[model samples]
Target: MKTARIIDILPQCYSLFLPPFFKNPIPIESAATCRNCAMLEKPDSHVHAPKFFSAKTKCCTHHPDIPNYLVGALMNSDDPEHETGRQRMLNRIAGKTSISPLGVFRPKKFTLLSRNSNLEYFGRSEFLRCPFHDDEGFCTVMPYWDAVCSTWFCKHDAGEEGWRFWRTLRTYLENLQKILSRYVLLKMDFKPSISGLSIDVSAPLTLQELDDLPPPEPIYRKSWGAWAGNETEFYKQAYTLIRQLSQDEFARIEGIEQKLLLRELEQAYGLLTTTPLPERLKKNPELNIEKISESSYLLSGYSPFDPLKISKRLYDCLDFFDGSLTNQQVIRLCHDQHEVGLPEEILKKLHRFRILIAVGETK
Candidate 1:
């Protein structure tokens, strides 16, 4: 396997914040296939197979919080590719729709509805569709997308291991974004009023709040304080301030929680890239299997969106993995009894996806 670097998995916008040491390309997620989406339904698939996302939506369902620096970057970019995203940001600022000095937010109504429905709206509801998702089914803010958008993949190449790493990375980046945005506000001598700026969703929304309503003028003004009218300029300046922060300065701003999260992210990344096979394995009892053909079966336990395909011969070999035998023993037993030789790579994949579990482990 090729060695992966920190720069490979991170968003390009991080180049402004991260030190110069991080510079290398990592493996791209070929499995997710964004341009020609892999999540679309196939005509000949079995009825029991997982349904695909709509072509129009295709997992662009959740709204993301674009930090002040990113908002500024998008607004100030000169690249023609960024024009559509820039205009979208400008429109949001002009209309004062979910706009704050700190960042753009997911609207309260959508947030409430998503929460109320327990995120059943995810990948299914157009009502929760992202503002930056365009008619062409592309994200206008691609390179400058937020942590959540950047880190999430509908299907992972390393399966559950990949999912875990990205999820942890997303949390770490989110915390960093929050810290940096607030730091910029303080450095600009603007004291942010958290109560005034943050949406209060502890109580259910009123009927009026179910619309795309901006915050009341007085509260919005209170949140901005000194930078009330010059929101765009403030974001631009925020971008400049954040861009100039040295690695040491950045570290100084990070608290213990952030530090810990960074450590966890690194560990998760390592595990994702170098997933070790267990000594002994057993089949995951929860896997839902459907025979796709006389020779093949579809295994759907790793993820609801992506299923693993296995041959009927290999499916029969699963019974040998009762956790009592070592990996080599199981392989030898299968080869001797059924004349079926299991590949090391395929066994690793099965373990990664939890289709096969370690002897003492529970998922």
Candidate 2:
């Protein structure tokens, strides 16, 4: 069974908040097979995926906010293979482009463009491509990837349920990243100015502002406070501070909203991992069926992105589950009348994916 521990869910810098008991792996969605490129067009691809992404930039377009501790983790990695990524980090720091005491960020112009433009540019635009993405289409800083990079997936095995779990987890982790990075700065006695580098994004950008220039030196220096020139060392120190935090210390630092989010995340995770079949089943009234071939139909509606392919013979048997009979009775009826045996596992998947619904449940 494919699984990921709680520790595996986020970058190592955030591991101080996770309990030791959660190190045990439990079942979760399968990792995205990046090499195979699920979003790309393929002759044998079963899912009706759009050929929107090029192999060179398969959803590696967005700039992620690498928190200070994670930046330190990337720099301090002992793995010889991480040398290239580490050097890239040094280059970004030395360039004084997007580097801030909080960590690396997207330039204001790119951030403005992303806010204003349609999402059509997300996976196709080179302007928004991540610097950590190498020429070979591999992530250079995989081990110390930020929360956003860690939680994103193009597809989910548990369909909408899986998506919900990941979405909640992403929000929780993002919030934690912000809170904890600030906490690290405070712990280091560096009082980062909150209003030092404000951008007025309410108005449309002028052509000059769209030049994607780095922040002015004075403002950047003020934002970094005492850690302006010593960013690398400060980040390393931030990593050490966060690494030493006990679970109780983390809990004390986290707010009520974070606690609520963590609870929601736990509930979502439970729903994703557990598949409970109802006693009676019925075909979802809202399903959209497309005739792919004479013998096959694509069933969608639970999630538009993850469609299930069903045989025409099985499609015809959907009416047998009209909430009038038990699941076993419907299974028997299908087999006796149409010579189609409905396996328990397939039924569970169909129900889990919402192709089949519980008799009285509203989707």
Candidate 3:
């Protein structure tokens, strides 16, 4: 049996390596592959999923199975000519992001990873088509992993940000792995675990040994507690770390985080505003981009109101409306003066509204 290796130590050292601005991370493989992760909205009640999985889930577990080709590219560092990500990354850096040290060291789902760090068991949703993925469906960078990312995969959480988010995850894991490796050697006096494990901090680390560590909790898939309970708290720490960095270091990490946040926010925010599928459909729906495309808008946690409120109000209002109501009329119904309420303009944009003007002219 092959031994397990974990970058339990690396996150500490390389926390500064990550950019600030706090983009969510994507999984390495299928979201379901992660025995530790969960699918929100109760994708399924299968015992392996996070607490949110419900039997009513209709999301089919078909996250385009990634063949060895894409995996091979990710596993190796053979940067291909078509690797548009390099440019994309640079462009994002030039855009809204600054190079700042992000507070990325917060731990997630310690219990799950601690119990099972099996790399082979990632979810299919975790597998993805990277934005940089070519028509051939292969990553441009086929080599040179920082190590941790080469081995991580997702639990196929429906909430997972697409592969674009994985870039930072890849970097974070790589750096984390390095930190864990060094710490393990120091702790073990420079020796591998008895099973010749690639890495093993399984020696039962104490909070003391892991001191100076941020108190982080696990979030299912790429989803997190966007409320003051978790999201704000988590972002606070992340920004705090970035703020401490010198301009150059902050810029470096911030640039990467900006790209990550934008792509992830695309999905999260979209879900926030769009009409959540019928309750039955949400319980058992096709999760392909095609199916998801029908949704009108992406509402993000960034909205002033509770993300679910907009969705709930939309659903409740839909129930009150006759299907015959014009789209504009429906939008008007959703409009509210309360700051927490959805505005017609913003709602229209969020739902990707299609306005049709009646054309009657003297011909």
Which 10 consecutive positions of candidate 1 have the poorest summed lDDT?
A: 19-28
By lDDT, the candidates rank as 1, 2, 3
Q: After superposition, how far is residue 89 of candidate 2 from its true place, in Å?
A: 2.5
Angstrom error of the Cα, residue 115, model 2: value is 4.3
Candidate 2 residue lDDT tens string, 1-363: 677886776676566666454474545555456767666667776554433566667788878878888888888898887888899898888877766777777666677777778876666777778888887787888868777787777767777677787788789888887887888867877664543233456767654446555457776677777677888998898888888888999889888888888889878877777857889999999997788788998887576656788899999999998998999999999999889999998898888778899988775
What clash count goes with each model?
Answer: 0, 0, 64
Give me the runs in candidate 3 sitting further than 4 Å from their true place. Answer: 1-12, 15-171, 178-196, 199-313, 318-330, 333-341, 344-363
TM-scores of the models, in the order given:
0.92, 0.87, 0.23
For residues 1-363, what per-residue lDDT tens digits would candidate 3 score against the true structure?
121112222222234444333332322334333233334443334232222422222122212111111222232223556346444433422331111112122122232243464532222223222323333333333232233334333321222222223344445444433333333323324223221122234466445325423223331211222222332233234323322445365344434544554455455534432434221111011111111123332232211111211334343443323334554555455464211343445433332221111122110
Q: Indicate the residue-level lDDT of 218 in model 2.
A: 74
TM-score of 3: 0.23
TM-score, predicted candidate 1 vs. hidden true structure: 0.92
lDDT agreement with native, every candidate: 0.78, 0.77, 0.31
lDDT tens per residue, model 1, 1-363 = 344666656555566556443453344566888887777777765666666777778799888888888888787788898788888888888777777777987777777778778554667677778888888888998767788997888887788888888799789889988888888877877764543255787877654455656667876687777777788998888888887887788778878888888779778867876888989999988887888889988887678777888888899999999888899999998899889988899899888878898877765
The number of residue pairs in model 1 that clash at the backbone is 0
Query: Each model's RMSD to truth, in Å?
Result: 2.3, 3.0, 21.4
**How much is the lDDT of residue 224 in candidate 2?**
78
Quick one: ranking by TM-score, best first? 1, 2, 3
Flag the better candidate by lDDT, 2 or 3: 2
